[model samples]
Target: METMRAQELHSFYGKSPVIQGVSFDLEPGEFLALLGRNGVGKTTLLKSLMGLTDGCTGGLVFGESNLLSLSTSQRAKLGIAYIPQGREIIPGFTVRENILMGTFARVDGRREIPEYLFEMFPILREFIGRKGGDLSGGQQQQLAIARALAMDPKILILDEPTEGIQPNIVKQIEEAIIRLNRERGLGIILVEQNVPFARRACDRFMVLDKGRVVVSGHSKDLTDSVVEKHLTF
Candidate 1:
């Protein structure tokens, strides 16, 4: 079975080590929700997984292959797609052009947008000719997700995907995420503060506090006490 494991992992930004001694394992098609309070290392941990950090120590393995040794682009080529918090769509590019950018990492170099992407987020299709910067926040978030899907990645990591979106669009994004995991069998690592959504959609959950994983278990095992202790401010 496919697996991604981090052993005693530490990630640094310049002289500052933001993530220390973090460890976890994600099997194929697993959805792991990463929960944490503000200033914790949740974002950095995701960056480390994608080799976006300044440097990292220890081991990161995906199946039989080692990932820490790979570069950011190399990691993306290995079927790991990261949709960052800021929805980094190119401002000057059209909506279609932004989504097509993800295909650059495809191992087979395929450029076609997956039909399911449009099915999942129809607004992207409707605004295909519009510039990405002109779209609303909800639409940009959807566009970001659609861009990542265009790569046909095996592991999808999203950071606060619904942070600022409207309620209706949040529901749509949530449904899309669940469908991707249930129907497509993609392993997902979601960094989110929405406990209700995380509990409902994830198979397992992990808590990061001050850089280390303080708690982790099946999503069902994540109770109110766990949230109050580690997740709540």
Candidate 2:
């Protein structure tokens, strides 16, 4: 695992700036939660890291590579897997195919789905032959996560993964995320709205108000006052 650093990062969609001068460091195997209200550029910051923005400037370094110079595919090959909001699994593809699709970005060029993925997401294993569109929303979210894990990434980035999920599945997903970070040692950057979960699961938390970090510290320092002031909408 390698450290990811962003210094004075700014991201734009066409000519409009959505993420303005944000900076942070994600140490190897560290879980960082991004907390904020809607449309505050949390997603944009994640996209910027993956080079999905139309344009960006500043320093983004993952390990020894300068991420700004890499294309989205290149970044994935570098072991950064992103599970965007809405659980964008290929609806037309079978669950197996969708998970295999992630292997295309693997540097090893091997397309085998790791057995551990099945162990982590048993539901996916049970529905391996089913079409992605047939599964419920929570199942699709699990599929999305399994697909990302198939890449064998060193860092996992997720956007509001538990949103709209069933309460039971949400607990499962949260436990899986914690296991991925603590047991598998996968560094994580999670954009989430659930304050209690964020406070409990993350090593550090960053509160983004308007495309910039307003408050940040160890998870232990995430006080009620901070949540009431910046997170309560």
Predicted structure with the largest lDDT when compared to the true one: 2
What CA RMSD would candidate 2 show?
0.8
Q: For each candidate, what is the lDDT? A: 0.93, 0.94
Provide the lDDT at 110 for model 2.
91
What value does the lDDT take at residue 233 in candidate 2? Answer: 74
lDDT of 2: 0.94
lDDT per residue for candidate 1 within 27-137, as digits (tens), equals 999999999999899999999999989999999998887898888898898889999999898989999999999999999979988998889998988999999999999
Q: Which ten residues in a row have the lowest lDDT in candidate 2?
A: 116-125
The C-alpha RMSD of each candidate to the native structure, in angstroms, is 0.9, 0.8
Off by over 4 Å in 1: none
Q: Give the runs in model 2 whose Cα sits over 4 Å from its true position.
A: none
Residue-level lDDT tens digits of model 2 in 99-149 = 999998888889998998888889988999999999999999999999999
What alpha-carbon RMSD in Å does predicted model 1 have with respect to the real structure?
A: 0.9
Query: CA lDDT of 13 in candidate 1?
Result: 98
lDDT for model 1, on a 0 to 1 scale?
A: 0.93
lDDT for 59 in candidate 1 is 90
